[model samples]
Target: ARKNGRVGIVTLAKRPWLTESARIFLPGLDLEKLLDELQIPVFYAFEHVSRRVASFGTPNSYVAAKRNAMSECLAQLFGEAKQCSSAMSIGDSEIELLAIQELMSELAMSRFSTPLESPLQFCKTVLLRENPSLVQLQRQIESLANSLGSLVDHPGDLSLELGTGRRLRLRNHLGPNLR
Candidate 1:
């Protein structure tokens, strides 16, 4: 595998499932020297690869940014490489990273009703707080409340004024003195 220029090598030191031959072969392998001979770059990054998918910006902004940048860089590197296999390499622990990522993504899809738009939600929640246009809405509601309050006078003279800008005359239902 090391002799092939197109084969990307990822060395994992502690794999319990390694076959007897693989166990023997791993100790003899000089990863740095082999990669140098092949002129391939090795990126020792498990933080991003093994990161839990369900975390919608839970860790922090910096870690999320770093993870995004790392993934983007890897993707770009792989896309620009001469061959797909020659572009990237990972450590032993990263062997299960792809599966974990896929499973977590599926879980997130099933678990959440909406896609977590953390930054947008944060800004919107901060700006709007409870109401989107509290002052304007409040003024309108207060005006309506006042109109309703005015209409709820004596039972003998029922006068209900509805709507704005235009006023419609409503005839009184009862006489002047109901006593």
Candidate 2:
């Protein structure tokens, strides 16, 4: 209906007679191992929404991320086809650009992630709006990216430390003296 919801999951207790092999859970796969492998930080930020439940981050990040992955893993539980609706306005990209001024010098690839930090609220409100054109969203993302001017030029080996000092040395050339 509204594209996003949430619910708890449970394994059915009743086993009907004449149960087929397809009804059984397949063995041999390590469920814990499978979940640990996902990119937890990414999925936490960009939530997927669809016809079924809208899952959030849990102690079991794998199950949460999987249900959130591609929106409504419950649909898969029902063995139905994926949503035909295409609200995937955002293109496929591993990088989500954030707005940083010239003074700042940190670019983190961790969770609680953000793509833009200026004029902050509006972008999010319009992200799922069907009325806005795709170009508008792209512009928003680009505008957000452009705001982080430091990233545009300082593309080199660098690090951002929390407690200590310098941690990166990149292969960049020094400029001539302006004397």
Candidate 3:
């Protein structure tokens, strides 16, 4: 494994029952310490690799798999950070976050009684009626998407900046042009 151009070796183990099954070895950083600091279980890396191998083919190398797993973990961390920051901006407590989670859960469970043109429209209607505070957040998200212009239509061309000083490219495997 390599972190910031520094070459290191990672040792991973799999155990079906253990929570922190995966392990890593680096020159300066301790895997257990790092995971503790990040507040993420070591098994997250294993879970990521397992899911990737199940969905796609096995990775070419352990290093590649490790890098991909780390990328996924970092992306998740950044997403949580973005959500927390947005929620904090709205209020001091976690009410906004909890409300958003509840709204998403409700949306997922809802079986729209009436036929709608699109699921997005249905969601918008529900949000407008159920939670007005989320309307501004939705608009902000839509504005961000709109700023991407044509990239919004072509997911393969979309690259998301996760506020981690890195750009994550959306790969469209099923698309005719895989770039």
Compared with the true structure, what per-residue lDDT tens digits does model 1 show for residues 7-117? 332222122323333447678776556556776543323334444532444334323333333344434445532112111112122222332233223333343454452
Listed in order, each prediction's TM-score against the native is: 0.23, 0.17, 0.22
Candidate 2 residue lDDT tens string, 1-179 = 11131221211112231132223543556433433444111233224433233343332333333334423332443333122211111221211111111101111211114433211111100122234466765655564344334422233322221112233233211111100
Candidate 2 lDDT score relative to the true structure: 0.26
lDDT tens digits by residue: candidate 3, 20-47: 3333223455555664655644322345
Candidate 1 off by > 4 Å: 2-5, 10-30, 47-97, 100-179
lDDT of each: 0.32, 0.26, 0.32
User: How good is model 1 by TM-score?
Assistant: 0.23
Error of 2 at 130 (Å): 7.0
lDDT comparing candidate 3 with the true structure: 0.32
Note the clash tally of each candidate. Answer: 1, 2, 0
